[model samples]
Target chain A: MFFHIILERNLQLHPRYFGPHLRDKLVSKLIHDVEGTCSGRHGFVVAVTAVENIGKGLIRDGTGYVTFPVKYQCVVFRPFKGEILESVVTMVNKMGFFAEAGPVQIFVSNHLIPDDMAFQAGDVPCYETSDGSVRIQKDSEVRLKIVGTRVDATEIFCIGTIKDDFLGLTGDPGGAA
Target chain B: MASTGGEEEDASELKLGEDFLKAKCLMNAEVALILEKKFETLQQLSEDASSQFSQVFEKSLQYVKRFSRYQNPEAVKQVREVLSRNQLAEFEVCVIGNLCPETVEEAKALVPSIAKKDRMDDEQIEQMLADLATIKKYE
Candidate 1:
């Protein structure tokens, strides 16, 4: 889910980005610098919602750079250990498969997949039933539940499972040819 | 299906949670999925109060292995809300709500063994059937 969190950042503005459009430059720069980035304290900063307060700017002596302590509200996404998420399958290997739900990468081990589905090696690696009725391959959208999550300052790694009901491939029943 | 001595049927189960606790509780990989949400909620509380619930929490993790899939929490919440509104028993609601039978017969199948022994009335059965119809939306 998304959460509104207050985050403070010391934004350094280049002297060129000062003057008439100084605030505009700061706001745009804040979005470019913070959005899509992850912090240990606040998960993933989805967006720089609003600049709550822009404190007094201090000009550096030699660089002519202005440092502004900007307090802002942002929407953050942090997956809990048991949260269910839908993601698109990105890779397949003997160990398991990797999926991406926005910036979060989920890994579903073959051990956690349904016993009925098996791995098949070919031009495109995939998990499939012996009958070829259900297949999971690259680009497949799947519903998985997080069992473990490791959030780093830059990215989140999750161990997910699709072994439960209603938590597997969401698209058409197997476009297997 | 034959415990039919209606009148003196162990009044204790009527109080709360006893009948459901007594039901042999066989949930295969396909059906036990209804327990995932409850397990998740319990697990969260356990983490918050770590020592207090450690035993039960550990037991539940072992129990969850029987149900292969960890179901969608949103779907589980939606079904539970509807079941509670229909006035079903709390403990049993977790079982039936998660099983999420799509039809009256399907719903009936879940409790028939216990229903026979308990002599569950026609009205309670009807309410459950109706609840299932509404629960289908979540599935």
Candidate 2:
């Protein structure tokens, strides 16, 4: 899921960057330091939408650095367990397949895949049914239920399953274009 | 923190824990629109060296562009309106908008919380699906 939320961060600026463009420097630095980072509380900080406030700067005597508290709104993507998500398959192997829903990587093990679909090995590995009507391969869009989520300091991993009703290939494979 | 709702972390029940219960949920279409506009202005401001974005930003841009069912802002807004008019929760509204399920059954399956005893009936789910389909058709 994507959330638009306000987050606070304290940014440290070197004394040399204190000038007319201090605000710009601060905002840009905030974006540079925050975007793409993942926290256990917030899954992934995708983008910084707007800077709400910048607190009064406090200078450190030893390092000649200024610490300014910044509040900004950003878009974050977090996958919760039991949430149904549409993802694109990124790779296929005997172990299972790895799919990505935005920044979250979900691994669907063979046990999670429907029993009818068997793994096929070749140059382009995939899992397909007997009739071959439904296939899961690289770039195939699928709707799956997140069974588990592991949120780390810098990464979020998930285990998904496409074995339930209404959860499977969403679109034709290799036709994302 | 105190457990005000006293609900467990269950997406099927729409009890999305305390951290996300009140957070504003953004659909893929809304995200796509926001990112595109932000990217355009960011590009204009930083045309030189520091313009490259982070992996999360880049990946999210690509993902939203690829998965967003609604291509235009108006369609996105209308989808939200239709869902809101039906009294769906914030999370359900975005999930329905993002998935664009074709049938009421599928919608219920995808978001089981809506199927809870008194929340929504089949007809209401059908109507919502039809409304969403219309937006996608005309979008």
Candidate 3:
């Protein structure tokens, strides 16, 4: 004879896209996989459960028993990805433009600029490099992705690559209408 | 039962008073009684009735002062900010829907003029009023 215990309670979780049966199976698998996983520099699993579905990939915590939408396949737990720094263009030089995003002055290489866009001077109300190779306009929005980090005797620098999408211009991502 | 009937009468009087007020007619003791009853109803609807009532009352007062007096400067500045903030569009529509002015002409005439001090163009003011009309249709 086999006996199973089903508990019901409100849970604070994102709406799940999968049904209870599938979600239960997935959660069980995840627990089994991470049962003996080691935690160190990489990160480790925390907790796993199923949640109610609220459409648009949203799950909410409801009164007990994990409720998930009958669409999602699985759920996984992981540590935060990384940190994002915000900066604004201060000046544009031939090498790059200076932007201050959260007390850090970083340079955005001219090569990282989008294609077919020329650095026009005077017409635009922003600083332009002498050689016109690099230009940063005033009030231009920029997001830097952390690629590497460095620590010196008294100073700390974060090297980032500005090649990803949604890293330039507010509302410029996907060309908002 | 007596108290409830009295309360209903008081509420009816209050609704009548509000109608008169919206029509820009002078307030009378009887109309005041009716408005008072309407306010009582509002109070019953929410715990924060006083604050809500005050806000709506203030907005209505501001509209009357500017619309009746043709003082356009401060009102114009406010309208401009509303336009720039994209809030005016929503607000005007809501007002028109809520008030549901009898006729388009009445609604157009009710549009609050910008203050002369503000010096906004007539075209811009007209456009804002037109937007209000659009809201009235839905309401």
User: Against the correct fold, how does model 2 do in TM-score?
Assistant: 0.94
- Candidate 3, residues A1-177, lDDT tens digits: the string is 000111122223333424666555544444344322322211112211233333332333463334323321111111111223344556655455665432234555656555433455465544334565444476565544443333333222444445554444441212221
lDDT of 1 by residue, A111-167 (tens): 999999999888999999889878899878776776666656476677889997657
| Residue B49 lDDT, candidate 3, scale 0-100 | 65
Q: After superposing candidate 1, which stretches have Cα over 4 Å from the reference?
A: A15-18, A59-64, A173-177, B1-139
Off by over 4 Å in 2: B1-8, B48-51
| Candidate 1 interface CA RMSD, Å | 19.7
Candidate 3 TM-score over all chains jointly = 0.24
Show pairs that collide, candidate 1: A163-B69, A164-B69, A164-B70
Tens digits of per-residue lDDT for model 2, B49-86: 23477778888888899899988889988999999998
Decreasing TM-score order of the candidates? 2, 1, 3
TM-score of each: 0.53, 0.94, 0.24
The top-ranked prediction according to DockQ is: 2
Candidate DockQ scores, in order: 0.02, 0.50, 0.01
Clashing pairs in 2: none
